[model samples]
Target: MRLSHKLLRDAALFLILISMPVYYLAFTYSLKESSKSRELIVTRQLTSFQNTLKEALWNGDSPYTRQIVSTLGNIEGVSSVVLYDDKMEKIQESNSPSKRIPFSHDMYKELESNQVKQIKTKSEGSFLVSLITKKTDQGLEKLGIIKIDIHYNDLIKSAHARSRTMLAVLLGIFILIFFIQFLYLREFLIKPLSDFEKAISEMNVYADIKLKEDPNHVFEIANLTKTFNHMGEELKNSAGIINQQQMQMINVSKMSALGEMASGVAHEINNPLMITTGFLERIQKAVQNDPEKYSEIAMHTEKALKGTQRVAKIVKGLRSFARNGSKDPMQEVETEKIISETLELCFERFKYGEIQLEITKTVSGKIICRESQISQVLLNLLNNAYDAVTEMPSKNKWVKVEVADSADQNKILIYITDCGPGIPKDIASKILEPFFTTKETGKGTGLGLSISVGIVEEHGGKLYLDHGHDNTRFVLELPRA
Candidate 1:
C-alpha cells in the first residue's frame, strides 16, 4: 500500500477503534434510559396502589389495606410494600418472606418535597416511596405514605440483556462496513498505487507511457493518475528531444572521423596513381622506341594496369565506406570483398602505424543487402581493431579478419579479432551503447560500434563482442542469399 492509502486505512481503523466503544456507550445509555423509564412506570404503578391503601384507611378497614399492599408486592421485582395512616403510623405492610427489606424513617422526610422517592441499597434492592393523599371538600388531605422495594438483580439482568443484544448488532454493522471499505480501497486505491509504482520503476527513455484509464471514483486518486500520465507524456517528449540531439551528435561524430581519415585515403590513392602514371610513361616510351621490344613492354604495361586497378579499388572502397544519408539499397554484396576493401582503406593507417594485419578467408558467399551499409560496418570494425592494436605496448600487436560460411550454410560469419588489451569485463556490456568508449577523449568518437551494430541489425544480422577470451574478438553474422 502507498503511504497515503495506508494513512487512509489507518484513519478508518482509528475511527472503527473509537466508534466501537462510543456505539457501545450510546447503546448502554439508551438501555439505561429505557430501564429508567421502566422504573418510572413501576413507580407510577406503586404510587397508584396508594389510592387503594387510602380508600381502605378512610373506611377504617385494616384487612383491605393489607390486601392492597400484598397485591402490589406480588408484582415482579417488587420485594416489599408498606402503607402508613394519617398520623405517620404504619397501619399495613406486606413483605416477601424470603427476601425482607427494611424501611428507614428518613425516607419519609425525603419524600416531603416530591410525590415519589427511590432509594438504592447496595446489598438487597431499591426502594420506591410515594405519598398518599385523600381528596376532601376543603382541598386535599395527607392520608399517608407508601414504600416498595425493587430487586436489583432483576433490573440488572434486564439492562445486561439489552446491552448484549445491541452490542451484537453494532458489531455486525462495524465488521460489514470495515470489509466493504477494505475491498473497495484495495481495488481503487491500493492496487492502482502498487501498479503505478511498478510502472514508474520500469519506465525508461523510450518506454511507452500510456496506462489503462480506469474508472476510479476517488477524486484524489483520479487526479493523481491524470497527473502521472501527463508527467509521462512530458518525459516522452523530453526523451524525443534527447534522442534527436543524440542523432545529431552521432552525425557530427561520423563526419569528424571521415574528415580525419580523408588525408590517409588521399595518400593511399595518390601513391597508387603516381606509380600507375610512372609505369604508363615508361611503357609508352618503350613502345615508341622499339616496337620489336613488345614482350619487355608487355610486363610494364601489366604492372601499370595493376597500379591503376589498385587506385580504382581504393577510390571505390572510400566511396562505399563514406556512403551516407538513409536510403541504402539492397544488393548481392560479397562479404570477402567487403572485408578486403575495408582492410584496403585501413592499409595506409596500418602501414604508417606499423600495425600487422592478417586475413583469413575460409568460404566466400554473397548476401543480399545494402553493399555500402555492410562496407561501413566492416570499415568501422577494422578501424576499431586498428586502433585497439595500435594502442598496445607490444610490438607484435596484430588484427585478424576472418570470413567464413556458417555451419548451417544459411549465414555468413565474420570475426574481427585483435591481439591487444581486451575490453574489461565491467565495460563490455556498454560497448555498443552510443557514446561509450574506453579510448582517450579526443582520439575516439565512441559511436563507431553503435553505428556498426545498427547497420548490421538493419540487414537482419547480429554484431557482438566475444567475451571470456584472451584477446578482443567481435563477431558479425549476416544471412546469406
Candidate 2:
C-alpha cells in the first residue's frame, strides 16, 4: 500500500485495539453502578416496609399491616413481595403463589443474610431481591423476614445509556486524532520529500550549486538537508580540481612530443647556418680590398651577415627545445623571450609548409617558471597550429600567437590561434586526454596537448581549448613574478 494509506490504516487499527478494552471496562463498571443504585433504593424501601409491618403486627392492627404491604408492592419495578414467619410459613404476600410460600428456610436465611441480591427466578428477566428482618419492639428479637423482588430494567437501561455515550465520545476523539495526524505527516514529511525530488531533478551536475536550506521544524529532515548541502559543495569543489588536473595532463603530453620533434630539426638546420656564416665572413674580406667595391658590397655583406646570424639564432633556439628531458628549477624569465625562442623552432616549419605565422606581444612581464618546460609548451602549441593549418584546404593558411597581460595583474595570457578548421565540437573535450587524437594514425601521438597541459599546471597556470570561435584558440595563462 502507499505510505499515506498505510499510515492511516494502521493508526485506525491501533485506535480500535486500544479503545475496545477501555469501552468494555466502562460498560461493565456502568452496569455495576446502576445495580448498586437500584439495590440501595430497594433496601431502603424494604427496611421501612418491614419496620411498619412489624409495628402493626405487634399493635394488633390488621388494617395497618395490609396498607403497608400494598404500598410496598405498588413501588415501581417491584414484581413481588412476601412476608415469612420463623418457620418459613407465608403470612402476607403480593404477586406471590396463593397456596404456600415457594421458598425453603435455608433459602430465606441465605437471601436475608445479604442486603440485596440479583437472581434469575425462572422469569424472562432477572430480578433484584432485597431482604429486611422483622424484629420485636426493642429490636432485640428476630420475628420474621420480608423479601421483595424488584425488576432490573431501570438499572440495565441506565448502564446501556452510559455505554452509548462513552462510545460516541471515543469515536469523536479517534476522528480528531486521525485528522490531526494526517495533517502533521503531510506538512512535515510528505510535502518536503516531494520538493526535495524536484530540486534534485532541476540541478546541474557540472555547475556549482547550493541547495536551499530546509526551514522545517522537523529535526530529522532538517539534518538531512544540511548534510546534502555539505556533500554537494564538496562534490562541486572536487569536480573543479579534477578538471584542472585533466588540463595539466593534456599540456604535459604535448610538451613531451615537442622535445622529440625539435631534436631532428635542430641538427638539420645548424649545419646549413654554420656554412652560411662562413661564406658571409669570406665575402666581407674579399670586398675590403677596393674602395668602390667595398662600399657597394659592404652593405650587401652586412645584410647577408645579419641573415646568417638570424638563422644561427633560430638553430640555437631549436637546440634549447631539442633537450630530451627537463628537471629545471623555477626562475623569473621574460615572457616575450620565451615566445620568441619557441617560434624559432616552428618558424621554418611554417614557412616550408606554406603557412603564415603571426606573433603579437601586447604586454611584457617576467614570469616565474622552468624556462625549458614553458618553451616546450609554446613550441608544441605552434607546432599543432602548423599541423591544423597544413591539413586545411584553405589557400590562406596562418597561425597567430598573441602574448598579453591578463586582466589580473598577477597573470599573463598567451593566445595561440589558427586559421584552419576549428576543433570539432564533438571531440573537443577529449582532445586533451592521453592517446586521444584527431590526426590520422601514425601522424600524431595524441600526447602533445596532454604533456603541455601538465607543464602549465606545474607552474600554477592554466591551459585550455577555447570554444565558440571560427578557429581554434588554445590559451596558456601563466603567473608573473
Candidate 3:
C-alpha cells in the first residue's frame, strides 16, 4: 500500500488495540454489578417473607404457616421457596414444576446466621439461579429460616442481550470513527502528496514548471510544496548554465584543432620558400659586378625572399605548436628526444622572459608512448612552468624538467618544477578542472591542464601535483612501453 494509506490504517488499528480491551473489561464489570444489585433486592424480599412466616408460626397453628409459605412461593422470579426451623429441619417447601431445589441445608445455615446473603448455583437443564435470604425479625424473635431461589438464567439472558446490543453500538461507533479519520488523512496528507507528485511529473515534461499553493492543505504539506517548487526552479537554472558551458567547450576545442591544422600547412610551405630565397641570394651575389644591372634587382629580390622565408618559418613553428597530431602506434620512444622537442617549442618564451630552463635526465631508456601526444603534454607543462617562473622576481626565477626510470624499471617518471609563488593549498586540488583558471580573465582558457590530464590517463599513466617540496611540482608517471 501507499505510505499515507498505511499510516492511516496503522493509526486506526492502534486505537482499536488500546480501546477494545478497556471496553470489554468495563462491560463485564457492569454486568457483575447489575447482578449484585438484583441479588440485594431478592435478599430484602426474602427477609420480608421470613417475617411473615414467623408471625404466623408464633401467633397461630400450622394453617397460618402454610398460608405464609404459599404467599412467598407466588412471588415473581422466585424459583423455590422453603421454610426451615432454627434447628435446621425443613418446615415447608414449595417449587414450580419447571424448577427443583437440589440442596437446602447450606441455604438454611446461611439464613440462620443472621447475615443478609445471596449466592449463585446450577439448576436443572444447564440453568443457573441465585439463592438469597434475610433474618426473620427485627433482631427480636429468632424465627424459622426462609430461602428464595431466583432464576439467574433470566438475569444472564438479559445480560447477554444487553452485551449484544452494546457490541453492535461499539462496532457502529468504530466504523464512524474510521471513516472520519480516513477522510481527514486524505484531505490533510494524501491529496497534497498526490498533487506534489503530479507537479514533479509535469516539471519533467516541461522545463521551469511551477505549482500553485494549495490553500486546502495543512501547514506541513504547504511547506513541502513550497520546497519542491523552489528545488525545481533551482535545477532549471543550473541546467541552463551547464548547457551553455558545454557549448563553449565545444567551440574552444574546434578552434584549437583549427589553429593546429593552420600551423601544419604553414610549416609545409616554409621548405619551398627557403629554397627560393637561397636561389635569389646566389643570383644577387653573381650579378654584383654589373652596375645598373641584375645585381641591385637581384639583391632586393633576395632580401624580400629572405623576409618571406623568415615569415614562413615563424608560421611553421606556430602551426607545429598548435597542432595536436594523431597518436602513433605504441612503440619504444627515446625519452630525451621527447623532452627536447617539447622544450624547443617553448624556447622563445623562455628566452624572452630570461627564465632559466633546466633538464636533468637520470635514466636513458626507451619508454612506451605515442610521441606526439607525449610531446604535447610535456610542451604544455613546460610552457606553464616557464610562465610560473617568469612571473616571479628575476633572482629567484628558474624552471626544471626531470626524467627518470621508476625504481622497478617498469615505468618512467617526469617531474616539472618551477620556483615561483607556489600553488595555494586551498585551490591546488581543483586546478585540473576544465575552465577553472587562476589566470586573469581572457588570458587563459584553462583547458591545458585538464586535457593534459586526460591524455596521461589514456596512456595508462598517473598525473598529479606533488606539494611535498617548497616549489610547485607536477609529476607524471607513465607505464613502460
Candidate 4:
C-alpha cells in the first residue's frame, strides 16, 4: 500500500483504539442519567399520592380511597397499584381480579428501611411501595402500605436515543481526524516524493546535476534529496572521465590501423606515380620530336594528368583517414562516397596477381557520422578481409565486399567476406575482445574488431560476424540518416 493509505488506516485505527473506552463510558452515562430522571418523576407522583391517602384514611372515607386507587392505576407509567394492612396481608389492589398481580414478599426483605416503620420508603419493582402515615399526638401514625408498579420503558428508550446521538458525534470526530491526516500526509510527504521520482526519471548522465530543493519538504526526505544530489554529481563526473578514456582508446586504435595501412597505401600511390612518370616521359619525347604533332602531345599530357590524379586520390584518402575524426561533429555524408574513398587505401591488395577483389554497392543514402572514424572502422574490417583471403590456400583467393541499404528504413548494412569458412562457433563470442587475433603474432594487432565495435556502437549501430554467411563475413550495420 502507499504510505498515505497506510497512514490513514493506522490513524483511523488509532482513533478507534483510543476512543473505545470513551464511547462505552458515554453510553453507560446515558443509561444512568435516564434512570435518575425516571426515578425523580416516579418519586414526585408517589409523594402526592401518599398525602392524599393520609387525608382519606384519617376520615375513614372508603369511596375517596377507592377513587384514589382507581386514579393511580390509570396514571401514565403506573402499571398497577396495590394496598396492604399493617399486618402485611393484601387489603386492596387497583388491578381487576381477573388480571391478578402477585406481590413479592422478598421486596420487604430487599428494602433498605424496616418494613414495619411509620413511613418507610422502598424501590420501584413490579409495584411501587410506600407507607401511608398521619399526624398523632406524639409521633407520625402508621396507617398501611401501598405498592404501585411504575413502568420505566421511556427511560430505556431515552437511553438508546442518547446512545445513538453519542455514536454519531464520535463517528463524525473520527472521520474528520482521518481526513485531516490524509491531507497533511499528501501535501507534505507524498507530493515531494513524487517530484523526486520524476526528477530521477528525467535525469541525464552527461548533464550537470542540480536537483531542485523544496522548502516545504519533510526533514527526512530533504536529507535523502541531498544525498541523491551528491550521488548524481559523482556520476556526472565519472561519465566525463569515462568519455575521455574512450577518446584516448579510439585514438590509439586509429594510429594502430594507420600503421598497418601505410604499406598498402604507399604501394597503391607508387603504382600511380610510376605510371604518371612514364606518360610524362612520352609527352616530353613527342613534343621534342615533332612540335607540329600537337594532338599526340595533348593526348600524352591528358594521360599523364590522369595518372597524377589517381596518385592524388590515393594520397587524399590516406590523409583523411589519418586525421583525428573525433573532433568532428556528426553530419550527413554520402555512404557510397565514404566506401569508395576507403577502398582506395586497399587497392594494393588487388594489385598483386595472387588476390582477387570484387565489390558490390547497392546502398544509396546519406548517414550521419564522424567520417574519419567510420573510415577507420571500414579500413580495419577491409584489412581483416584481405588478410583472410591471403591466408587461405584455396585457389579462389578472393575478397568480396557488399554494401546495401537495408529493407528497413532505419538501417544500412555492409558485409565483407573472404574465401574461408566463417569464424568457428566456439571463439566467435571472444573475437570482439581486445587483442584476441587469430592471425600470426606480428601481422595482427587484434584491436581492429574491438575498436570497430566501439566505433559502430558509438554511432548507435553494431558490428558482428554473420555466421549464416558461407564464408568468413563481418557485418556492419549503421543507422540511416
Best prediction by lDDT: 1
Q: Order the numbered candidates by lDDT, best leading.
A: 1, 2, 4, 3
In candidate 1, what are the lDDT values of residues 286-313, reduced to their tens digit?
A: 6875767776787768777776877777
Best by TM-score: 2
Deviation (Å) of 60 in candidate 1: 4.3
TM-score of each candidate? 0.52, 0.61, 0.48, 0.45
lDDT of 3 by residue, 1-481 (tens): 9976687688768767856675666556656766667566666665665555555666645777777667666765667776666565677766753575455565444443445555565521111222223345575455556556666566666666776677667767877887797889888777777878887777852376777788877888888888988898788867756854785577457758777676667767777777877777777777878777875687688678767765665565456556555445766888887777667667667877888787866567677777767877887788778767776766757888888888998888999998888888788988897777788876666777887898889888988899798788999898876
lDDT at residue 213 of model 1 (Cα atoms): 72
Candidate 2 whole-model C-alpha lDDT, 0 to 1: 0.74
- Model 3 residue-pair collision total: 3
Candidate 4's C-alpha runs over 4 A off are 4-27, 48-60, 67-76, 92-103, 110-128, 131-142, 200-211, 255-481
Query: Residue 473: error of model 2 in Å?
Result: 18
Off by over 4 Å in 2: 1-3, 58-67, 92-104, 110-142, 193-210, 262-312, 315-326, 330-369, 374-481
- Tens digit of per-residue lDDT, candidate 2, span 253-335: 65557656766777787787788888878888987888888987889889988887887787677667666445776889999
Candidate 4: tens digits of C-alpha lDDT, residues 1-481: 8787788788778777867676667766876666555545666666777777777767877688888888877776566677766567666677654333455566554543213211112322234567676668987666667776655566557666777788778778878977887788788778877877887887888766566767778888888888889988888878866865675576577686875586467667777687777868777776776768877777868777776777777777776777767789998998888888887778775657377766765668888999989999988887877766676777777777788877877898888887855677888998898667788877776778887899899999999988787788888899999
- Give the range of the ten consecutive residues with the poorest summed lDDT in model 1: 317-326
- Which candidate order results from sorting by TM-score in descending order? 2, 1, 3, 4
